[model samples]
Target chain A: MNIPLLSLKSILSRPLSTLLSWLLMSFGVTIVVLILLVSAQLKNEISKNAQGIDLVVGAKGSPLQLILCNIFHVDFPTGNISLKEANNLSRNRYIESAIPMSLGDSYRGYRIVGTTKAYGDLYGAEIQSGQWFEEDMKAVVGANVANLLGLNLGSQFQSQHGMSEEGEEHEEQSIIVAGILAPSSTILDDLILVSIPSIWNVHEHEEEPGEHEGEIIDLPKLGIAVSQEQLEEEEITSILIKYRSPMAAVMLPRMVNEVGNFQAASPAYETARLFNIIGVGVDVVNIIGILIVVISAISVFIALLHSLKDRKYDIAIMRSMGATRRQIFVHVLMEGLLIAILGCISGLVLAHAAIGILAFYLEKLNLSWSFFVNDEVWVLTGGLIIGMLAAIIPAGLAYKTDISKTLSKA
Target chain B: MIQIAGLSHCFSDNVVISYPDWQVADGEHSLILGASGSGKTTLLHLMSGLLKPTNGSVIFDTQEINQLSPSRMDKFRGAHVGLIFQKPHLIAALTVKENIKLSTFLGKKPEHNRHIEEMLDSLGLIELAHRKVHQLSQGQAQRVAIARALINHPKFVFGDEPTASLDDESCMKVVELLKRQSDQHGATLVIATHDQRVKNHFSNKLEL
Candidate 1:
């Protein structure tokens, strides 16, 4: 109590220096913590959405784009590959399972994905209402999609021509909501799922007698349906593959890419590459945070050193009153400790404040934020240690003050 | 009783200062009279154990202060001696009352709040006790410094030109206050000063 009161008075007596030191320290800590939180959140979101899909096969294009389109469901696929060729890879001895996905439509702004019950099985999806789609034009909605679009069991909505809001609407065709999937908390939660026949039927009706007027229409033939004009060759946007063995990871992507007409991408490799690109930006932010923290520590050291020099006479007086060198040393160190603790606490609040803003924005997009990670605790401890280290030199100088010489000079 | 024998000091340049042997009886107030280069402050510091002498010892009764370890020397000084410096230095951050409290804490005594309050009341500083040191006038600050030095009521009180900068009237007042406080507490008092106004305040004079 005695030491604390003395240190508090000393700090209060020099208000401007104390405040300047604290603000700098807190700002530096906040930035460091901000970057860590963002980096952690970004890595978690990417990996969570990717799940365990081992490989993606798409029309020849950027592998990154293939993973983004097929696995993460964030970008448009590079046109489409033949369903026959995609199925051929499904039969590969090293492949455990393959799920094909066809996408070119949206209800509202969320994509309508044409997939099989296997895709739902791959994600461990459970039905919240009704049952899975059994026939053409029957759709199963994901939890978030159902909530955001207000399409419950038995609701119906028409599909748009492409996966964008401005796509031409397929007004003549509407899909019935056969079921709603429970919350998977993955990319699937944002999608409206239907079977493959629905995609073909919707597009098949798109260019019929209304536009043909008995004119010869050049339609790529699908083997299943030549009763009407043959549509374009049957295609799907991509295939998601699960490898049967750990060794398949070495050969699968290479084998699929060797097929020439199509290319293969690994979710891990593509996501790593994407993060490497983003890591450059995160690295810059990290460097800036480190510089700010270092400068804050230096400023604290300077503030303490300058005050120690100024208080020589006061130190001499304390000595005359019989203060031990150790007492004086601890007295000055207390100043540093008080400043550091206050700054650390303020920085934590600032870090949480920034996270609050980020979490709010993520929630609006139907995404959840993860907090309470181990790195945050480390930051708090490291910040306080730096504060104490900054004071060490100044405290030693106070302990070595020559009392009699200082008093005689005074 | 304070005893000194063959005490001396030297600068790195080999300029040596030698002191004549002297004894100050308990409760006796003495003044060391000297000019600017007379080493009066040096003598005061050496005898008070602020600086170890080059040759010889200062013994308060039978205990040789210079022979104590650094920490033990500080403990000894706190319990047995008090000092008033020329400039009336106090911690600028603390109130007058807190400065006295700090002194008592550093004195190595079991907590002595009652003694600090009595010192403040005796020094007429009870009203200004809560005011910060910077807010006090020079004279009030000097009184607070005195109260701090004497709060422990040591066996000896030493002043290093405590009244050199004050006007004659205030100087006399300060010297008289130092003497009266030391007498009431039964501690020996020694003032190192060239100021002529302090000459009449003490009977035993040591001319350096």
Candidate 2:
């Protein structure tokens, strides 16, 4: 009872140690929190986009990568699956909707995705300016790209042929910015979208006035438009398939692998894989947290134990005044608990600050995911428990103190 | 009222004390007199229930104070006993008034009720009551300690070498203050000290 106030004052008295303990504890918790926050947000974004659309049918590489590159503008595609094959598959009774993508180009480091208008409405994207491209050479840019590049409707921009901004051009095909999308808190935030034929037209144009003139250049084929008559005429990278029922989930990956060059990956499986990848980082942080808690406990124990020596006269005075050993024990234990509680609160505040910084960076880089997820309470509770554990060993020492030996020495 | 029977103690192999018995009636003023290492502090520790006697019982009222659980003894001590140290040992973080208030708070006693100023007025500490413990001088800190002890109006008062560091004048003032306050409340007063200067003041004494 009396321990609460006394412990609070004692902790306040040693501001430096309390602050250090708080930082150390929060640092560990922050990493764990960041991992949890980002992963959950990523999962939410995936699941949200994946809703209604049941399965992904793609060229047989990494299904997760295909999803990331196609559905989400976060990575480069392995390649594209045939459009004719995709169209044929769309006619299946189980297939509800189908959209195709032609990739490989960037406008100022933002991906130039050559896809349909369904890409926008599927992810619930809104065009703030102009309209979705219906013509071959028109483009629709994400809100972040529009703002960052200061581009507006009808502005003509050229796309580079690779991931980098400085990637070489295959031809000077000017694209009109037909639309700009609103922020959808998804992969749609960092893209320069255009009609799929725009990608085909850009690559199909004759090479410009270069020294290698009159050379008939071949297009570095990424994916083919699948035609039943000439199925082997072109190469294709990957495809995204949507199924009507759980039957596709069970049978599609098996069938797609048996048939296509690309791999069929479920985002769910890949997300779990991502979790396993990050779980090691969490484990390291947890070990550091446990160590800091133990060290903090030791710090408290040593501080109290050393104080007990200097406080002999003080203890003698209290004892003389009629404080029992139990009272003194409670007094000391309260001090430790108070310090732990203070450290925990400070750590939680610190973790949130770190989260803010991380969120800002993610936004700046136009990263599709966020580190501020919904499960904040878990991190806060975890920090408090660690702080409480740190106080236990020191408080226990106070309980075993022998008053007679202590006072006699004085 | 207080009573002790066949109390004995040792420190890891060294026999520090082996007293037969001791008794103090209500309202008695006694000095536990002894040389250095003669177990005067040990005797005070037993009386306060800070240490249990290896053998013997210390009875205060109808209960064996020595037999009480540690927490129970603490509650009893916080509520009914007042202690004064030679060094004053006030918590350095608190102001003089706050230090006294702390004791009352711990004891669960009624608020000192702005009578903290009145108490400080008696001890000539009113002007300095708002100052922190570390800000006070030797004599001022000792006066603050006295105000703190008396704030709870405890039934028994114990002084462990209360005036050991004070000059003749400050010591006399402190002793007179202690006797006046103890007599005013009809409380039992126990002083454990090697200082002989306090001998002429009390009517009753316990020499070890």
DockQ of each: 0.64, 0.45
Question: Candidates' lDDT values, in order?
Answer: 0.82, 0.70
Predicted candidate 1 versus true structure: per-residue lDDT over A353-409, tens digit per residue: 878877677642332333656887887787778878888899899999987788777
lDDT of 2 by residue, A1-410 (tens): 25567667666666776556555555555555555655565567667756555555676666667766666657777776675555555565555565556788888788887767766777888888789887778999988889889999989888889888888775568888998888876667778988665776677556332112233322212122322332433223444456777776776767666664646777667766866887788677767765665566566656666665555556545554555556666677666666566655665566557666766777733223234555567656655555555555554555565655665564
TM-score each candidate: 0.88, 0.82
Model 2 - which docking category? acceptable
Model 1 chain B is weakest, by summed lDDT over 10 consecutive residues, at B108-117
Pick the lDDT winner: 1
Q: What is the lDDT of candidate 2?
A: 0.70
TM-score of chain B of 2: 0.94
Instruction: Report how far residue A408 has shifted in candidate 1, in Å.
Output: 1.0
Q: What local lDDT does model 2 show for residue A97?
A: 60
Q: Which candidate leads in TM-score?
A: 1
Share of native interface contacts recovered by each model: 0.70, 0.52
